[model samples]
Structures are given as structure tokens and as C-alpha cells.
Target chain A: MYGWIWRHLPGNVYVRILISTVLVVGVVFLLFQYVFPWAEPMLPFNDVTVDGAAEPLGTPRAGGAA
Target chain B: MALRALVRTLSETCITIGLVIVLFVVYLLYWTGLRAAHASDDEIARLHKQWAQGPTGSAPAHEGTAGGTRDSGHDGGTTGGADELAGDGGAGDADSTAPGHRAGESFAVMYIPRFGGDWSKPVLENTATATLRRGLGHYTGTADPGDKGNFAVAGHRRTYGDPFKDFPRLRPGDPVVVNDGDTWYTYTITARPYRTLPGDTGVLKAVPEPVDEAATPFRRSGRYLTLTTCDPEWGSSHRLIAWGRLDATRPTAEGKPDALTREGR
Candidate 1:
């Protein structure tokens, strides 16, 4: 099935270029705009406080604390 | 058949050119809109009047708060970390004190003297989409300009040419200023260095664990200025975090941002 589909695929340069561009753009949009963004944690990035002497791991996030 | 093919090819070429022209015009419109927004007459007047009254004597420094200036003066190029700035061999001072922010925009330039030369604009989180390549990212989850909680910001350190360029220069006692219209919010550097992952959960936590048993000061709660940039400046590894508290606020209409008020222990 795969061999047959590949053989039948359009060999035209313009068609190939257009299809490739669309695929590349779609992948990028999905990864950067939707997937990566959706996965970012709440307050995805914030400042950290590390105590060197104690060598203890810092505290966790305080969701919406006033 | 050949003639027909030629006509079709010509039509396709025309369409491509037309699309390119359309995109070019749209980009021009976007640029104009940004400039107008930044240079609105009222905004310019307010800044000018404020600067005239302030001790800086000149217009409020464009590099106001986070790390670089927000002024529309320079093309949005920034260096990351102290070494990059220092490596510039003293080239970062070109427009250090100049008015970088245009007029109408709610943005300010941030400059760290220790960061050498490049300055960046810490823009409102909402407006950061267009300005991300220029400087820091304002976290929407955080507090407003002066409300409370951590007013967090993130910027790239390695990629896109290090727009947070001088974030590493930040140390305890340095001033981080944010100018919005007439208000100039100043933040005093506090705490020591901390590290976290790119999406580290610990970075934006509401409050830091107490170092000592002493009671914490609530008055300084909520209001904060956070600086975040790529860690290991050369690599895309963890992030470097710097925290500052609201020390004092002075309007451009008021004289200088009182240096004494920002004096740290």
C-alpha cells in the first residue's frame, strides 16, 4: 500500500513545494503554538530562591496566593 | 498547449508577486501602528513633562526596569548575560540614558550598569507578543504593575541573540525601574541567585521559604519584580532567577526617583 501511494504521488515541482511548505508550517504551528504552549506550567516561568549553604531544594509554587 | 501553459505560468507569477506585495504592505501597516502607539502625542508629552520635572533632568532613561530600555530608538538587538556585555568591551553605553520608549506604549527600558551596555524593554505581558524578540516576557499569571504577588518576567538568554543580554549583571541593591505613563515603579534587588528549569514550577511560587524563623514582612508582599533569563547563558539549560521588591515609586512628574529611598542593607 505504501509503495503504491508513493509511486502515484504527484511528481510536479510546484505541487511538491506547496505540499512540503504546508506540512512544515503545520508541524511548526502545532509544536510551538499549541503543543508546547499548552504544556507550559501555570506561571510556567518564575524566579527561584536557592540557599547555597543549606543546600536544600527550594519551596514549591503557591498557586494564586495573595 | 505551450501558449496556454505560458499564460498559466504568467498568472501564477502575478499572483505570487501580488501576495508578496500584500504581505509587505501588511508588515508596513503593523510597523506604523506600533510606532504610532509608542509615539502618541499625549504619551510623549506626559513622558516629557515627567522627565522635565524629574532629577534625571533628561527624559526618563529608556532602559528603565527589567534589563534593557523599551524606547523604540534602537533596532531590537540585545546581548545575554554579563559576560556578553563585558565582552562587547564597553560598547553597550551608546544610548544608555536616552529615551528609548516611544510615547503611548506601556513599556519601559531596563538597563543594569553591571550588564555593560545593551538595554531591554520590559513590556506588559499582554503586549509582549510583538515584543518578545525585543526583550523579556511578562508572565500573565502574575500581579499587575503595582498590585501584589510576583510580577514575573522571562527572557531568552542564548537564542535570538540574548535579548535579556545583561540580566546576569543584576545583584542585590540594584534598581529595576518600570515606567508606565506617568508612573515610574522602582524595584530594589533582593535575595541571592537561584536556578530552575525552563518550565520550572518553583520559580514563580508565591513566596520563598523562610530562611530564618523571624516573621516575614507582609507590607512588601505581593509587589515584586522578577528577572528570568536562560541559565548557563551559552546553553539552553536551566533559567537564572533574580528577585527584587518594590522599594519606592516616584512619578516622572515628581523629581528624581529618590536614590535614598532605594538604599538597601
Candidate 2:
């Protein structure tokens, strides 16, 4: 997927490099600002808390008291 | 031969630039979060130490008692225990004497059992990047803790410990507790955090609803808490809000309140 995109980017080596750099950064900025945060639910993060004193285990969605 | 060698060197330079760009992305997405998390931990530790060293300049954090600040309303100091009357029964004025609640200062420690028993974050004074990067920041213009208004705060939904990452998981009636100078103010989540536009500052109001200034005054009478973070977890187009109402308050000297007691049920 990446290789194909690299070949299609028109320009001499230097211009191609500049264009690729800009494209990569723009895409990354968009992803970081929007795509990544939106994917938080599907991501495996926030499933566990790092409690140093206790046995590390996954916790259920804690909603109720105690 | 020289031209071929020149071409080879140019290709190497291009590869190097690409590598550098990749590294920059990693730093932005991953390293920055790690740094922010560490900074937050440090700030929390500092606040804890400062509070430990300073005197809690109010009435004891005992139940059903307003520690009698000259300006803090003392009408309903009787809302004590697990049944702290929620509708403005005992919430007092924002303790102005506490230096922590001032802009750039770390005021309180927020504990949400629904997030995790060990999950605690420092609540800073302002909403600046430097402040929010450390922990949750109390919106300066909003009500302070235990006040008869919205004690609104903002935090990073995805980074800087992602303190509110599980905010959506918090259901109604869950406890959202804060430890200011002396009291552990326990609030109950009102409902799942609803969404709103980024410009909607009205949700931070005491009533937790939008209002038009041309129609009515911009304030309400209640002890509410508003937690806000970016919406969609990946974008800043909107906001995700979690609203809670103050339910209980206990003096630090008396030990953890009933809401924190996780024994049988």
C-alpha cells in the first residue's frame, strides 16, 4: 500500500521528498486530532489501571457504588 | 562515476529525511502522551505535599457542617454523611483562601471509582495547556468545589493520563469525589455525558443546559459538577460532558466516606 503511493507521487527526488513529507504530516495531524481519539473505544487502552500494590487484573466497566 | 555516487548519496539523504519524519510522528503521538502523564504525576505529588504541609484553613471536614468561611453561605451546614442533600443543601462558596484553586495552582485530587479505585488525578486551577497537561483543570470562571453552582472542569480525553478516557463508562449514580483542602466532596453522576458543540460554554452553567443571555440570566442555583473533554476521542470538533451533582462531603480527618467503601456492595 505505501510503496504504491510513493511511486505515484510526482516530482524529482527532492520535490518528491518535500511533497511526501507534507502529505505524511498532514495525514498524521488529521489522524491524531480526529481519527485516533474516535478510535479510543475500540482501542484496548483504559481497560486496566496500574495499581502497583495489587495484582494486575482487568476491571469491568465500574459504574455502581463500591 | 561521480554522477552515480552523487545519486546514491541523494537517495540516502531522502531516506534519512523520511526516517526523521516517521520519528517525529512517533514523538507527537506517543512520546508526548508519556511526558504529559509523567508531568501530571509529578504535579499530583506536589499538590499532595503542599496540602500535607499547609493547614486546612476551614471548619473540619466533618459531615453535615459548613466550615464557616466568612463569605461561604452557612445556611445548610447540616448536609452530612452518604445522604448529603444534593440540591444546594450544604455546598459553600469556593474556598478563596486556598492558594491551590488559583490559576496555575493544583487545588484538589479527583477520584472516580467508576474509572478505577486507584484512579486519581490532580485538579488544577486553569484550562491552559500547561495546566491541563498536568491533570484536570477547573474552569476559572465556573463555580468552585462545594459551591452552589457548576464546578466545571476540563481534561484531555485521550492523553495526559487520559484521566477521563473511561468517562463514558460512568453511569448515573456513580460517585465522583474530590478532595479539596479538607473535605472530600462526593458527587453522583447525573447521567451519561452528552455531546455538544465546542463553542457551547453554556453546559458549564449550574443547570447544565444551554441558555440565551438575551432571554435570561446566565446563572442557576445548584451544586453541580461538569467534566468536559474532546468528543470522538480523536477529534476536537465537539465535546463530551459528564455531569454530576454533589451528594456528600466528609472531613479528611474522619476517613473515607461511604461512597468510597468498597467492601460487600
Going through the candidates in order, their DockQ values are 0.03, 0.03
Q: Please give me the DockQ of candidate 2 compared with the native complex.
A: 0.03
Q: Model 1, A1-66: lDDT tens per residue?
A: 323333565868677667667865775556544543333222222222121211122212222211
Off by more than 4 A, model 2: A1-66, B1-10, B56-100, B211-220, B263-265
Best by lDDT: 2
Q: What lDDT is obtained when candidate 1 is compared to the true structure?
A: 0.45
Clashes of 2: 7
Q: Model 2 over residues A1-66: C-alpha lDDT tens digits? A: 345567998988898899999998897777656664444333322212111101111112211101
Error of 2 at B161 (Å): 2.0
**In candidate 2 chain B, where is summed lDDT lowest over 10 consecutive residues?**
B63-72
When only chain A is evaluated, what TM-score does every model earn? 0.44, 0.55
Residues B1-265 of candidate 1: C-alpha lDDT, one tens digit per residue: 9897777778877985675456444433343335433433333355456545644332233223222322221321232232233222222222222233332233444434344432324453321323343344455444434334466665555333344546666678877766554445667777554655454444443443233323222233345666666566654456677777766555545544544333321
List the candidate 1 regions with Cα displacement exceeding 4 Å: A1-66, B1-106, B116-122, B126-130, B159-161, B208-220, B255-265
